[model samples]
Target: MNWETLIDEESLALLLPAEYSHFALPIKESLAVFLSRLPQSVQDRLVEEQLALPVDATLSERLGRLAHSCPVLQKLGQILARDQRIAQELRSELAKLESMPSTVPLHSIESILMQELGPLESKSIELLPPAIAEASVAVIIPFREKNKPQQPEGVFKILKPGIVQRLQLELDILTEVGSHLDSRLHDLGIPPLDYQDTFNQVRDKLRCELRLDEEQLHLARAARFFADQIDIAIPELFEHCTPRVTAMERLFGEKVTDHNFTLTTEKQNLAELVARAMIVQPILCKDEQALFHCDPHAGNLFSTNDGRLGILDWSLAGFLGAREREALVQVMLAAICLRPEKIATTLLSLDIRGQCDQALLKECVAIWLRRMREGHMPGLSWLTGLLDEAVKTARLSLSSDLLMFRKSLLTLLGVLSEIGANGFDLDQIVMCEFLRITVMEWPGRWLSSPNSRSFATRLSNLDIAETVLSSPLIAGRYWQAMWQDSIERYAVCANSR
Candidate 1:
């Protein structure tokens, strides 16, 4: 759309409250700059198309509808929902993009199945009518093997034909917009390549969703990763699954939003189970290289009939390198202690964009830590808000992995809030898990290190009193107490089980 038509002066005023209205000029100029980047023909076409549409609708409403029509906008909406810098009402409006997307006709789905599975095999699986769920990229339909009437049926996920092509077009538009913002909005304090890198990452993730074979493997691997754990369950895939049509055991469960556990204990159990499964495992298993779910929102999680937390949608997953995992530990520790300098330092190091205004970054972090310490209850929104401001003030750019992590963490926190377990403290939960993980890894590390024996001999020769008075000794004692407390709690849970 042309810059003038898209700006919607009234909407702009509402979006940037009166206090920030001074920014309206710059924002409009930025939009104009973006429009100028498009080919004249394309720009004229878009402007004509937008002019033909109804102008009476509010800007937020118009954007919401646009998001529903475009995958790129839907992705942007997901990010907006977690960003505290945006107005809450606007954020909530943007969130509608993620609501049930337009579904494909049944005939279209059947055609896709027939093409992917061949006519004979397609007929072998009795494809049920209508779709169970529809998202921007794909629709899920339940099906059963014709020969195995007694066996349970599974769901087949079929990608909407031509979605990739449509998404590519939208992505191209977004890239142009990003490029213009990068070039024109120098005073906005964003690094030159920030938008380019972010859009590239989004493109990569969208491409990943096109690979159903890879997603199926991720499901199997995740199931294997948590095999020994009794509280988790992953959908079982049928042998006949293919890249375009994946058949997976249908979960007989309700999404967290739909399922009301009601009882306090049940809510607590579900919360703890999710905490261990999502946070603890990923943070602690640096050596094993944990497979982390990038989307753990309420819709993607279910409370199964068998009382286990059923995980769904493994298409978007991230692996934490050892260094990233260690940084996570340090970041959480800093957060728990309300150490702003440490928090700012660890976070800045994670940024891909080189240097930034360190003083400003630390100042922003300190304000957030103070609020959180005083009972504001830090969460995805708070963290993102702080980070967003810091990045704006410092012109720092975050890595793609870190951005995904932010989204995932926000999603996990959203689920936790919905469960409403009283006395839930994410910081404490992370601290306890961090201690347990450290304790579990320490012995193995000591045993494997060749210098351990020599170090122990040298330590034994030191004065016992002096050693006990040392900082390391005090820290060890504190961790030991935490470990013992964790063990006792686990024992209690086991006994209750």
Candidate 2:
């Protein structure tokens, strides 16, 4: 884990693409400068041996080593692993990092657990030797209660002994590196960005993962959120739980990425189930605060034997306030209906900090609409692309929660692709969810008093007005798109015949 050893020019050459090798020098210099400011003892601890990189490692292998070196980097790797834009070889290697080998010793884990929750014997908990699973910041050790032999096995998620310190050091290093890069934006030919602010936001979210109490709260909320949905399963919490140790019913299932699991189930059904559980439900839920599972990587998701999607790891979660969710819904509706003006207005409302160019925003929305008309599916990618363009072109500053939600959506898309869910029509799924929400929630929304009407309710009213006003045009566009699709299919059929 020594910064000097793994982040040197030679290692960077192997880890980075040949075209981007020039970035190595600046990166190395930044780390060197940052390390110099730290005390010698601190630096030594930071470089403590964890996982060693192979000397003759391939590009993907080297990347994996770097990711495993730090919790922050491990998370980045998980997100990138699902990204189809990355090289398949590299993605495959990164995917392996999701189920990291247990690096912390059993005795250390035992000591921490004893300190936090007393002796395992006293609590009737039989600690299983050797951790069952390991992730970026914690390890899952399966245990059984002596008194409840008939009950399902439970898991204890123990934080790594020095993870708090290690994570803090890593965040500091990142801040320093980000500051260095931001200062060199002109020389590096990179576009303008609030690198320091972005890193700060990321740091805050990562710190949230360290608080197991908050994670427990998140788990409880998510359980209630999906209580009525039989197809989705959330881990049930046990009586003995603490900030350092979480005891929950062990989820029994195979990773969604397992080929054998996919072979046994209908791919489309499984894919739809995942989409509903991860993306659609969070976006369209009636909750006053929208709760989203920020990390949906392959390892964190499971396909259970009872045909339910088991979601694990609630440490990293995101919430969108009522107004934010309303704005987001409005933007989505505008994009789907091809209303550029509405898209522009909705986006503008979200940019509270900066002055956005109204003209530029509309132009970007129009371009996005053109792509949609050309048969581009309006899923996470299409929506994010539009938002990214708006952020860059109009200098719009969106909320951190919305940005986190976007990142989650992208990760979900990557998971979908990994599980062979890419073949499912995302647009159709989105449309179905939208219609279902409108129908099921409309009555309650209408009955609410005007004084008590939430932002979401007001937005729902606006959405109804806009839809009614533009129904003819929206119907025409859909009809034309359908007609074009039918014609294309007919031509293919004729040619085949």
Candidate 3:
């Protein structure tokens, strides 16, 4: 490998998109940085831009980064957001607001406070998960390697539960005294569409809407690597529970949008496996709850040389408590089995709608049901479009809390069909899994883990998650702590980069 060549277009067409052609820079640069410590040939190919434009980094590498950052960030924010002395000091000043006339611009204090706050990021790379004793994963060690980990590029973190009551108190005042904040719009006056742009495009739109430049979007996305740090920057309100942060672990793998080998099926199989692992792991956890790693963008999805699927970024993960998971199981079963009304009924059980919109929800469910039954298998684009539109048009203000479940279902099925890799259909598989789970639950359904072993019995005697409907605090403090860490992870990873 030398400076003369990059991954040729023919091989690249299998993975890279034209729109993402521009993203080649960061990906390439990151790879170069990672490869620089490796053998001269690897260095020549990556650093000298001699390897093909898109080569692959494996999955474990990505996850290792994700897992490491998530915890580190949480640790950082726990120290900062929950610093009672700082809060006590800051809160002491709010009384002064009593002296100002009602018209005084107080929120300007936001800028002043932001200036005073400072945080840090993690150093070096988190290369892989601890070795599992049950299953062995083959590692494709590069010919030359660095003794220390290379940091992820372009990430940042935010404060957790800082000014908890005060911020909300201010937001309430701002909401009541609100002179309409600008509706989200680009200079083109074109509002952003949730479904239209893929991940990267969405970030660009975000930069514009938020008045940031290309560098900022890079910073934000790169922050995905330091997910562990999110909680450190932001603190949760309840001292009993920790806050959450979502972060990304950028993919370090060869992109394969097309199949060139006879074993092409491996790609889809691995992808579906990745998707399944994501769903299964949550249930495996004691709480049956974990952040749904939402972004599965190209840079986010990787097939390292060895072929394990890694999911990155738990930043926007959707968390499901015991009841929520149960409700979700019910809904997923209903959707796959083509029972639209049943799904709607389950949503109603979750109190997804107000009394007035019950009929509309049912009607919408009917529409979705009909599409599932009569139409071709659900397509990702169409489904994403509908999901986005429903939220946008939602007058009743349904929280997008369950969105990741919807996405997990869609993305699992989608990547399979797109690559023609496997017969993986989320609705189909989830339905099957539920039928088994439901049977298993018939007797053990109410059973809880040891930490919360008695919870099911208590819940059986009482309504829990549903009753706490509007709470942003789902899955309690343990999860909140995990979430907070996610943000810190991104922040640290970004700074390290």
lDDT by candidate, in order shown: 0.67, 0.77, 0.35
lDDT of 1 by residue, 273-377 (tens): 888788767766644356888767665778898988898888778776666655544554456544557788877787776767788777777667656644666
lDDT of 2 by residue, 93-141 (tens): 8898778768788999889988998887898888887887898989999
User: What lDDT is reached at residue 48 by model 1?
Assistant: 58
All candidates in order of lDDT, best leading:
2, 1, 3
Q: Is candidate 2 or candidate 3 better by lDDT?
A: 2
Candidate 3: deviation at residue 221, Å? 20
What number of clashing residue pairs does each candidate have, in the order they appear?
0, 0, 69
Full candidate order by TM-score, most accurate first: 2, 1, 3
Model 3: lDDT to the true structure: 0.35
**Candidate 1 C-alpha error for residue 314, in Å:** 1.9
TM-score of each: 0.74, 0.84, 0.38
Q: Compare candidates 1 and 3 on lDDT and give the better one.
A: 1
Output the TM-score of candidate 2. Answer: 0.84
- Model 3 ranges off by over 4 Å: 1-252, 256-261, 279-288, 313-316, 332-345, 349-356, 368-396, 404-414, 422-424, 435-497
Q: In TM-score terms, which candidate is top?
A: 2
